[model samples]
Target: MSAGVELDHVTVRFGEFTAVDNATLDIKGGEFFSFLGPSGCGKTTILRTVSGFLDPSEGMVKIGGQNMTGIGPNKRPTALIFQNLALFPLMTVAENITYGLRVRGVDKTARTKKANELLDLIALPGQGDKLMSELSGGQKQRVAIARALAVQPKVLLLDEPLSALDLKLRQHMRSELRSIQRMVGITFIYITHDQGEALTMSDRIAVMSDGVIQQVADGKAVYDDPATSFVASFVGENNPFVGIITRADSSYAVVDTLFGTLRGRNPKGLKVGDKAILFVRPESAKLGTGAADTTFSSKVKSVAFEGNMTHVFLEGVGKKDVTITVGRHSSADIPAQDEIASVTYDVDLGLVLPEGKMARE
Candidate 1:
């Protein structure tokens, strides 16, 4: 059965270095929750804390409403799947899957039955006798998951298990993992730096940065309505225009940017004279001046066609070059390099946020 996890005011410190800073989160039972951030953002530390591999310096860790302060990883009702997998090379697939059961003194017949059942569960039926060295990378990944599931853990922690796979295999395993999680009905706490992996697999994602939880929301909300400049810049590609707020209201604000006066949704409710940045997605900005609240013309620096979509880089709009994505159907209308192109975006689509630290590429 699945169990909920709770971290109340959790903080972890190694000597003087604080890795996780007072993070509070409630993860639902049987939910696929992901911790997403760049490297060294303390996501792995938080995962270790929940799995009882590391204790929090302050606050409480609870699983299924039971306090886990003094519990060890082996005692907790959880299992961890490391990035390296750590499978035994000499063992058969069946032996590797039932290693945990064998260590617990389970009889040979019972262990064999369990291993065969798990092989079927992971879609490797009748292949249990094959050596670990004989399986493909993707097949080995499934066997690793099967081994973790052998002990019937209520919560499974994955530390970038698919990072070593190729792009095609990684994408394929994303769906496979989600399907397996649903079938088992266990809480999955996944740690990953890849935005695509988290967004595609998670029911909810917690965006972390600099040992802080920046925002916790679903993938769509995190992508469309970011709570901070760090999240807006980190979660996806965006064109940021630095400016000062000239006018403000409840829903919208006008900013005096280098390009010109532009309007966008004022999500942070910044007042007039406040320093701000207007962020617009490349896809939201169209190559035209008609029917858009914000419009500007700039010289096209370059254009690259990637089959289905075209990327047009515009210069002289701001300190950084602005990117616009043109669809394949509209690629014929794309302006040549050195030619001027009019860029426009609707007020509802753009977001005006307080100026703060932006994510480094």
Candidate 2:
């Protein structure tokens, strides 16, 4: 019973401040879509608009090809799960799961049957009779999900529902949520500021900033081929080398940096003489490789020993903190503090973008 959702030229404003700028997006039914961004970046605003808690100042909100103009949340075929689970303290697990059915005047027998079915769906079968306080954090989360799903909403909107759990539990819930979505075949519209959560669960991600969507793509495309400088810096750890482009073409660009000329993919189509930033991921950087398109001698400032991979911080290059990641099992020697090291990276792995406002800046 999943339904498609669409925002056509949507804009939400609170008084003079525009919370969500003009944004048009189409979300396919049964797809796990996520809206990811920093706080106050209009992601939650869009979610609220879709949930019918707030109407857009301009444009249209549609679900299943029907315009949702002047529609209240209760009338819409959607269920929203907030960050706080908001379960009734005195209610039993079955009572919480069947609250919506009870509100609609379903008989106790039918409600209990529906509750047990949902408990089984959430992998918490046979635990319905227990009080809500008896369940653990992860278990309570599942009960909340079952409560929402019990209403059979075509579109389920979640706003950072897993942010309350511990790191391990949060990770566990990510898989659990995805599995539940696949099993129920409902369209899940998730809103989150956590990059890992979005990347781990979403079929497609819309990265928002300043009330605008910077990019909408799968996890790999968003991380590897960012369309903007903000996306390049926000999605992952990147070493940025700011300089003027010396050469440019459809596929590649060379930038004159502090270390020397560095070559990378010309994704933003910057021309020669344009100010640009070349982004190199730590994993794409190698140590002591002369075959790379860019090579610079750097002094090791520090090294973080992570299992399986070591992050080597380099100074005297790129005019900022440059990091290089190397496999711990590599035959190359790990550099120590103050040790002079040679850093190299393939040109294609570097994303060259026109100089613009960065996410951190």
Candidate 3:
């Protein structure tokens, strides 16, 4: 059975450098979880700790409520598929898949049966006799997974398994991986730098930056309700507004933006004198009639329409640019530059954030 993973105040240090700062996280049993961050942000370090590949400098790593303080990678009930699919080139598919059993002294018949079972499970039935180099890129990836599954570990640790594939193949593999996890009912802890991959596959995602976790939530929540400026900027495209809180209330707020006064919903718990930033997704802004309660203005500076959607750039009371997305139906013959326009959005769509990493950067 797959097991849940927990890190209680985990920290990893490399001499003077703290590769992974103090972090605490929990992974539910049989859930597909991902650690998502850019390179050098210490996602790999956290994955290593969970797999028992690296000992934590502080705190405990627990799986299924059991502490794994001194266990080695192989000793834990976990299987790690490294970024490089380290399959033995000389071994045939069956041989490579069953190599772990051979080491444990399983007879040839049992090994072959196990290999065939896993080959079918990975959707590559009856291909065990083929050479490792004979498969396509995606097929080779499945073969690597089959080899790992042959061990029947309780948890699977994948380190950017799809990073090496082309874009189409990578997209294909995301669905494939999620399906396999469901079929096997195994917990998957994936580590990747690609936000798209993590958003697509994970049940919950932890966004990390500079060894610290920024936010952990479902894909849509992380994208729509980011907790920090770094998360808002990193998870998806956002137009940022930096302004001091002017008129404030629990239900709404008005900010004196460079373009004009932005009146929108306020995320409660802000004092009158506090400085705030509002983040709006490109899809949230729209070209429409002005309203006293809306957050945008009517003046549009630029408009471009891709085949799929229309991208409108608005220059109003804000120092930075504001962008909005419209459906092709809504894109029909938008007004030209210096023409009268009305840009608006629901007050609830606006967010209030402190000046954060993204603001400083």
Candidate 4:
């Protein structure tokens, strides 16, 4: 029984400081929605506001079309899974999973039955008797999720629950969590700064910056069609060429950059003479000149071969070095150090946006 969540003109202020500034969002029922941003971007504040931990200073909060003005966290139909996962070490796995039921005075037999069912649901069948310390990191994570689901919450809020796990385990849990959410059919509101986690698991993502919602779209849209310069620079690797637009049209813009005059897709509709940045992704950049719209010559500074891709660092693209990613099976010949190379990219793959705040690495 999943429920939709709505925040209408929500604003949360801490005296002179505003944590969330007039953010309006609609999270559909049974959707895996994620709020992604760096720390201090008000993602946690929005989560707390939805969970009834902190009431918005202004505007309305609704759950399943019901206004939650006076409702407390305990009364709300949402369950919050914190980062630390406060499971009691003294209690057995079954006891931890049914602690919420025990607090409501459920019969011992019923609680035990519910615990076994949840253990099975979490894929830890017949492990109810194990202690908390006996379980692995990933197993403990599953138990925490089972405990949260025991109360049958309509909406489940997770605050970076996988941040503590290692890289491989975190990647594994992303799929596991998505599977669990689908099995139970509950609305999942996940908060995370990790782009991989959000992009991998979420049906839709809301990217926030400085207490403001920058863009709300699917993972592909956020990566390929960023609305702001911060988003284009933040979400992935990009080579930004800052210059003034010399020519503009409905679909394309030509910018006079340090390297040379470059053309790219003009989504922002920048007028001629306006300062802009042409962003080209490393993977989209090719070492040799083909039929690409833009081409530049640079000296290869270095080349590093990763397992699957080779990164060729080049100079002469201005103060900042340019990176060209070549796949292992790429047909282009790898250049040695100090060798001049031709870099090319199609205009359709490059983004020309108005100059704005760039994300720090």
Candidate 5:
């Protein structure tokens, strides 16, 4: 059983420094929500605030409609699984799993029974008596999860628990974590700097930078369409073309880049003279279409092939350095070049953003 969480205007301050600046979000019951950002972006600070290990400088942390203010981590209906996990190495897996129950005065038999049931749930049914040191890394991760679940917490907090694993194992663990969340039906709030982990495991992701959330949306939306220049550049690969808004309409704008006038989605409420940026993902850039809205030429600066895909870097056409990603099947076997070549995209494929709108992460 897991509980939903709500952070209303939650702000964390360490003396004069604000770690989390008025962050607000509602995480529904049984949903897997992720806080994703680079280090020192206040993601961990917010997670600590939610677990009651640290109180907010101001604002409220609510679980299941109950205020969590002044509540210690031990007293809250939430269980936090730190990156280290802190499993007792001297104890058997069963003993480690049931340590929380035993400390809470659960009878030995009952604790053992609960431990076995969780081991089974975690797919280690018959390994209860094995020492904690005997399990593999992934298995140890499962045991840690089982231990957290033993308390039947309404909310489970994980602080980058998958960071220590290798790439393949990390990918495997993302699926494991999501499946476990579904089985327990508890709200899971995960903190991670790895975009792949967050994108793979989360129901919704909050993109944070500079102690503020830039966008909170479903994974595809956050990747396919970003709300800000920061999100466009950070969430995934994008070619940011800086320019001034010259011609503006309700649906698109003509940006005056060094390469000349380029039409992009009209950002309404933007004045014609205001400086703005245009974002075009690599996938959106393609071979010339010979049409008015589908042409932009660039001097092919460089190209690199990584077997599955090709990276094309462009420059010299008055436009700044822009990269184009082409899949192996779709990419032509063109040699790397310093010569000029035209690249194109439909006008609708690019997004116009206000200049200097994103604070650094």
Candidate 6:
């Protein structure tokens, strides 16, 4: 049966360096949860703690409401699919999938039967007799997942298992993974730095930075309503206008920036004179719209056509370049380089945030 996982004020230390710092959260049973962050930001540390490979220096780890403080990974009702996969090259696909059952001394006939069932479960039916060397990268990934599932783990922990596949295959495997998780009806704890992977697969995401979780929410919430400047800039492409708040009310904040006054939603409740940044997504800015909530002029520096849309980079009222995305189907006029253009956007789509640490690319 599937089980919920929880971390209560978890902290992990390596010598004097704190890897994970007081992280507290819950992963619902049968839910797909992801921990997303840049490298060295302690995302993997939490996964390790939950997997029982490492114990937290402080606090508790629980699965199915049972404390996991003294448990070893082998004894826990969980399976970890490592980034390297760790499949035996000499073993056939079925042999690899049944390796765990073999280690537990399950009969060969039973192991083989279970392996065949898993082969069908992973959409690799009739390919179990093939050697590991004969499988493609994506095939190997599925085999690894099948092996993990062979144990019928209550919680499955994956650490960037898709990192080795090409772009198209990785995208395909994301769907496959999600489908497999649903079929098994188990809690999935995925660790990844790839935003696309997390956003596409997770029921909820925990965005982390510098050993701290910046925000935890559904993908749309994290993207459309970021709780921090770091989240706003990191989740997607954004044009930032750094300035001091000129006026603020319960619903809106107006900032006096190099590009003149700009108003946006005031979810952060910034006061006048407070340093803030207004983050407007490229698609949020429209070309030559007089009916918009805010209007600004920019000198077009470059244009890159991307089939469905064109990205226009401009030199506006600041040192940094501003980018606006124009959909091909829109009635807005596309401009040539060196031409002046007016851009406008609604205030509600713009996100104003108090200046804080942003993610480094």
| Candidates 1 and 4, the one with greater TM-score | 1
- In candidate 6, position 250 carries an lDDT of 81
lDDT of each: 0.92, 0.90, 0.83, 0.92, 0.85, 0.91
**How far is 106's C-alpha from truth in model 6 (Å)?**
1.7
Backbone clashes under 3 angstroms, per model = 0, 0, 10, 0, 6, 0
C-alpha lDDT of residue 219 in model 6:
94
Q: Weakest 10 consecutive residues, lDDT, candidate 6?
A: 289-298
Tens digits of per-residue lDDT, candidate 1, 1-361, equal 9999999999999999999999999999999999999999999999999999899999989999999999999888888888888889999999999998888899999999998899898889999999999999889999999998998898999999999899999999999999999999999999999999999999999999988999999999999999988999999889988899999998999889888888999988999999999999998888988544599778999999999899999995545789999887873489999999999987788999999888886
- Give the per-residue Cα lDDT of candidate 5 at 98: 92
Winner by TM-score between candidate 6 and candidate 5: 6
Q: List pairs with backbone clashes in candidate 5.
A: 2-154, 3-154, 251-266, 252-265, 252-266, 259-318
lDDT of 3: 0.83
How big is the positional error of residue 345 in model 1, measured in Å on the Cα after superposition?
0.6
- Model 4 worst lDDT window (10 residues): 288-297
lDDT, candidate 6, at 150: 90
Per-residue lDDT for 231-319 in model 6, tens only?
88888888888899988998999988877788899998889999999999999999885543477777899999999999999995545
Candidate 6 off by > 4 Å: 289-293, 316-320
Query: For residues 7-105, what per-residue lDDT tens digits would candidate 3 score against the true structure?
Result: 899989999888788899899999999998888899999989998889999989999889999999878988888898888999999998998788778
Candidate 2: C-alpha RMSD after superposition:
1.8
- Candidate 5 per-residue C-alpha lDDT over 236-312 given as tens digits, one digit per residue, 9 for 90 to 100: 77777778888888888878876667778864446688888777888887755445544677778888888988888
Q: Per-residue lDDT for 151-177 in model 2, tens only?
A: 999999999999999999999999999
Which is better, 5 or 6, measured by lDDT? 6
Candidate 4: TM-score?
0.95
Q: Provide the TM-score for each candidate, comma-separated.
A: 0.96, 0.95, 0.91, 0.95, 0.93, 0.96
- Mark the regions of model 5 whose C-alpha exceeds 4 Å error after superposition: 267-269, 289-294, 316-320, 331-335, 357-361
What is the lDDT for 15 in model 6? 96
After superposition on all C-alphas, the RMSD of every candidate to the true structure, in Å, is 1.7, 1.8, 2.6, 1.7, 2.3, 1.6
